[model samples]
Target: MYRWEQRGNLWCLNPSRPLGIVEMIGGGYLAARPQISYRFLLEELAAAGLVIRAWSYVPSLDHQGQAIAAWHSFQHEAKRSGPLNYQISRRPIRLGHSLGCKLHLLAPDYGRDCSALLAVSFNNFSINRSIPMWNILTARLGLRTEFNPSPLETLRLIKEKYVNPHNLVVRFNNDKFDQSYRLLETLQNRPNDRSQILVQQGSHLTPTSLGINDYGHNSWASDYLQRQQIGNFTKKLINWWEQNAC
Candidate 1:
């Protein structure tokens, strides 16, 4: 059994016995209701002895600002919640999916907040790719909403600001939207970096269970094979988090 609570933008979960804390951020809009879509993944982590604090947000034009806000929420909530023993021994491991990965990388104090980062299906798409064609056209014709740190700017900022040593980036085979390789390369730019990328046998949405409109709702996502694949990924993540927490 587990307990769930909401304190502003975070969803806090406490299991019967927790091994560590996971500060989780889901991709873009998915972050708004991560509990509903990531039910299986959240449960699996809890079962493996993780107390989770899932941050929820809808991205605005202010990329850096959003990242900073999320980071602050993690710190304040971790200090306020969690068992005293767990708090003293371990910093929450940062877990992110897709755009959430980008946010974590851009977080102002990312290096100091968590022990390591576990990025699943990391993505940073161009404005044209992320928004509808109509919106793109509108933006060009005067209706302007800046994508603050554009994809290129995001990479540049991460290269300059993020300096965490331990990082595990996961990429799904069929995730066309994923740019984990680019992220891994950026992380490797620093000397003696211990970042590693793991390729799994699933799509971009494999880490996500909500199942989007049509492409994500296919039998492939719900089949036994896919379930086993995701389960394996979750197990590996839990093992890595436990083994690496100092």
Candidate 2:
């Protein structure tokens, strides 16, 4: 039986025998929906004895501040929900995809919140790349505003504020929008940083299911390969969490 509950504004899924906890934040607009790729990932994790708490957020100019507030809120609610709701005796793992990765990394106390963070397809695109060409042009012309803590600003903040060293950054083979390498470099700049990157097979959207479009190639073999790739990635993540997030 699936046990669903609401803790604060986030939704929780309890497995029959949860071994640990995962707090998920999805990328881009998909973050607004509960049915993103993490939904599938969470299902697999549940079968392996894990519970999940997931939520969505609307990105704003003050994304950094918003990220901090959201992280704190998630923690506060998780604690209030009591230990049984999540296996709180064991620290929860942080999982984020695309823009969600940035939000988690930008939190001022990022290192202290979770046991470890798994960031997939970490994206920090410039304003122009994030929006339509016309919108970019308009923003460039001062006719429209752009997201604050821009890509550069976000990187700078990560260098200055983020202290956590245990991070797993994944980038798909053909994900044109991925900026994981950049984030990895910034993280490795810290003398004690243990951040690492994994290159997986598939595209930028391979790790996520946006629910609006088909992912991978339009072939049976392609679909099979993609599924296999995601399965492998999840296995690695679970193993890492068990070894490190605990």
Candidate 3:
């Protein structure tokens, strides 16, 4: 059974285990879709012996409120679970994907007490503006749009306040190679050189697609897990986090 609850404007998923970290899901419209995505990611993490608490928020409204909710969940879990015996001490890490990364980056004031941040597929200002013309046209027609907040403002805030000496931002480069490269360039210009950048083979959307369980098919989870690229990427991400965030 899932330990689900609505905390203020955020939907919280607290797995029935001592929380080791908190992951905030990025929803483009409503909480349900991202919650489903996060559930898959959490299952993968749980298989690797990491307990995750997740938050899903409504996209159009409650941006600030959702950020605060994520912060509170981390704080509450840290207080409850105490320190970890892992590499980077027992502090809880904040993991964000896509637009979720932007939200976390912009809300530095909220998660000031978090141990570190894992930003998956983060894009910088110019790179965000440089989205594919096709994508822009589709979005204009309300066809293909992801749940991204004010990406430029978010990056500016992160550069100004969040990316600093103590906390680290590890950006995973997947499909959006251009955005990832631009993000690295922007980080290089920042004062904090402690941030890390990694370019992986997959794209920004691949991770979510890889983790999906097609219930309509028989034994879908097992079949999905058997794919070569999925298995390799999953293992690599898990190992990388264990080595770095632990």
C-alpha TM-scores of all predictions? 0.88, 0.85, 0.64
The true-versus-predicted C-alpha distance at residue 130 of model 3, in Å, is 11
Across 11-107, the per-residue lDDT of candidate 2 in tens digits comes to 6787867777788877877776654445556666666787777766776667787687768867787667675654556777888889888888877
Q: Which stretches of candidate 3 lie over 4 Å from their true place?
A: 1-19, 61-65, 76-89, 108-111, 123-150, 164-178, 209-231
Model 1 scores a C-alpha lDDT of: 0.79
Q: In model 2, what is the error at residue 14, expressed in angstroms? A: 1.0
Identify the leading candidate in terms of lDDT: 1
Residues 152-222 of candidate 3 have per-residue lDDT tens digits of 65555555666533333334333443355554555566774545665565455544543433232336555
Query: What's model 1's lDDT at 224?
Result: 50
Candidate 1 deviant stretches above 4 angstroms: 82-88, 143-145, 211-227
For residue 84, model 1's alpha carbon misses the true position, in angstroms, by 3.1
Number of the top TM-score candidate: 1
Checking candidate 3 for backbone clashes, the offending pairs are 28-147, 84-90, 86-246, 87-246, 88-246, 174-202, 174-203, 175-202, 175-203, 175-204
TM-score of 1: 0.88
RMSD of each: 2.8, 3.0, 6.3
lDDT winner between candidates 2 and 3: 2
Off by over 4 Å in 2: 1-8, 85-88, 134-141, 210-228
Report backbone clashes per prediction. Answer: 1, 1, 10
